[model samples]
Target: MELNLKRQIGIFCVLLILPALCSAAFTKSRATFYSTSDGLGTPTGRCGYGDYGRTVHGGSVAGVSNLWRDGVGCGLCYQVRCTNPSLCNSNGAYLVVTDYGAGDRTDFIMSPAAFSSLGVNSTANDELRKLGTVDIEYQRISCSYPGQNIVIKIKESSTNPGYLSIVLFNVGGTCDVIAIQLSQSGSNTWVSLQRVDGAVFQISNPPSGTLRFRFQVNCGSGLEWRLPKNDIPANWRAGATYDTGIQF
Candidate 1:
């Protein structure tokens, strides 16, 4: 009977240790995400943060129904998975996550259905007024800029896929969609300035705050993206660059 008691104690001890071992293993197993080393996400827009080419899901790209919100069209959002899943309702209107915000949480934001319509991802069309935003609290903050005759260059990485807001400014005030141009080797290519009627352009970066802009080139797939300004800011970042991606 004592031997049996000892055996039972040994079994209990093993069971107790199993949970600890499993928990330790889980803690050690790190999820490979593309971002800064600090783990605090980008203060502003920065490119080459995540591997867009990689399959977010099992052997497939995580399809998002929408990205940007505001002044968008009305439609039913599809494929876009909600971190909360319930954040989206039956109505066509939902906040589309354009670029990843600077925060650490993974949330799916909705929009005024109108904002959803104009985006390239929008599909269904309905009454514009009915599709207005439901959740107004979750707004994205990122670096906005619009480039012009000023000579500049950005290097893109495989993780960058042009998901940012471009603005323009100097000592003067800044404007939205005022002007922007994307080129290859200082020459117009793929999406030349002439081809893109507007001044603003789309880029990949974090939301909120001022980021000293670092031009990203050929991010992984030979595309352009943005990176944190390794340098200091010239101004308080009074304004932003043009947003060409704001499809009229």
Candidate 2:
């Protein structure tokens, strides 16, 4: 009877500890900041994204090395907080993956403006200069938090009605896009779209007129949105790409 009672006590202890372990989310990483000194002649990133400093949360840009998977890392968001409790904010600072780094480092490279906003010490002479690098904890968050979402741009070939090209932007979240489908307006039929590359997809002999898209995320869910004929941009021209900021 005593042995059974001791076993029950052990099981109870395990249950008590499991929840704490499961709730721990942040991952440890090193972070540093960069600016014009970094010699980024062109502010635009490999992913074709730029103007990050002008985001709602000023200076929200960050760079990662090859681990960024080329342009695939673009538009992903993260919450970063200094490991030093004294310098950290209760809510941490939000960062967007806007560019890639040249060197191979596990560190998160933030824009100088982003680093300054992290609650780090900023003296009158130098803002965030004293705190050159810091140990931080970070976790990936959905881009939707910033009112950003996946965008699709269509490029039709005037000579070949059977060929269609599409570019995807602002791809981020818990899941990557696994598949895409399109349905002609007023039709119940759905047709598959084929991936041409990491950021492009294609469909041959697509139906004309207004259409809707269904994007299947790897997380076992899908997002659907539509574009009306009237909503098509006035500058849209065959064989010329036009960005349609359709979210989700």
Candidate 3:
């Protein structure tokens, strides 16, 4: 009876241990943010854990500002209001949140035609409009990075004060990097499927693609790690404020 009980107990242990190890091994899909200053990890949100479906877009085009603010084609889109009272004016418009925009400052893409619709074409108005740069304001992601040992840089993020963006990271070397639309490439309407932090992104290919890690952000902005890819200046320096590492 004692021997039989020991065998049964041993079987149970194997069942429990195997699944746990599997979870840990397979969990590499998630990203953990590590601090560059300290060796601590911050909490990266989970996948699909954010609202990319924000309702407001397009700041109301008016005055000389409207000449550049609402040029034309404004509907079912996004909005970028001026922080300065003298610039954006007192109204808002609806714009089609087109592809990736500027960067961490303004978080929307208002077509030039859209900016022209509001009337008033003055150089001062153009200057005022230029003050606001587009950025990613919403979305969430689990962060991870290679080395689980290196620290990542932190930055300010989010389009709205109430919500935060998303991000992910991974440890080790990266894989084949494919270039896509992180922002609007002139007249080209390239859309970004994901929001990224401006700090840096880390991807891992373990045992030669046996395992892949792509660190992502869940916030509303695109990441601009290098100057060459700084399509949107606003998205170049935004990210999660946490440390990353292996917990085990």
Candidate 4:
């Protein structure tokens, strides 16, 4: 009996520490920066964020390679800092994943502003820029968007009744939307939507009435389904945005 009790206690302690260890873990990788005239990321990014890509995390955005996870990694946030003591700062920069790219042995392709932010000073920043790519460590972090709820942007490619497409914006949280399903209002049958591009979901022959959305999210904790407070109107038009009134 004593041995069994001791083993149970040990297992409980391990469970308590595991979550913290997972959250604090960092990945070592190589990173490079892309240059734009305004020191910002491109609006026409691969993630389909459009002009909003230039504004997320105050223009501190990055294009990621394997981390893209086939577009499911879009809208995720990361805290990145270079390992170079001579040219880098300890604080580093927080960036949002807005595009998809890979460099020579690199995981993150950051914007100029985000890359420069890794430096200790202006002189250090200039030198770091010259290096083009640097050794770095990064960890996933929660995304925060103050006073902004997750909004669904209707893609221009969508047509009424025939096909529907959408991009989720302001997906603030530590979670990733791994899967999405939709159901017509007042119905119990749900239809799964396909992830076509980074941050883009589409389906053919959608239900006719107002639509409800549920997302499967993984946030270090197990995956959970998140329901939005609002539903897409029956007359939803292309290029119109619907406020889900929920974050994360």
Of models 2 and 4, which has the larger TM-score?
4
lDDT accuracy of residue 246 in candidate 2? 46
Candidate 1: RMSD over Cα atoms? 21.6
Count the clashes in each prediction.
Answer: 64, 0, 89, 0
Question: Weakest 10 consecutive residues, lDDT, candidate 4?
Answer: 1-10
lDDT of 1 by residue, 1-248 (tens): 00122232235346663232222121111001223333222223211212211211111111122232221111111222211223332222222122232212222322232223222332322222243322221211111112312212221221222244332211011111222334332232323222111112344433223233433332124545443323222222312222222211
Q: Which candidate is the best by lDDT?
A: 4
Candidate 4 has a TM-score of 0.89
Candidate 3 lDDT over residue span 1-248, tens digit each: 00122232235347663232222122101111111122111122111112211211221111111111221111112222333344333222323321223333333334443343222335634754454342112211111221343223322444322323333222111111222222233433333323242212222211111111222321123532221211223232345433334211
Candidate 2's TM-score reads: 0.58
Error of model 3, residue 202, in angstroms? 29
Which candidate leads the pack in TM-score?
4
Model 3: residue 134 alpha-carbon error in angstroms: 7.8
Per-model TM-score versus the true fold: 0.19, 0.58, 0.22, 0.89
Model 3 weakest lDDT span, ten residues long: 27-36
Candidate 4 or 3, higher TM-score = 4
TM-score of 1: 0.19
Off by over 4 Å in 1: 1-38, 42-136, 139-152, 156-175, 182-191, 194-248
lDDT of 2 by residue, 24-118 (tens): 47888777777665423224555444333234234466777643764456556667777766666545566666667643344578776556656
Q: Ranking by TM-score, best first?
A: 4, 2, 3, 1
Residue 89, candidate 1: C-alpha displacement in angstroms: 25
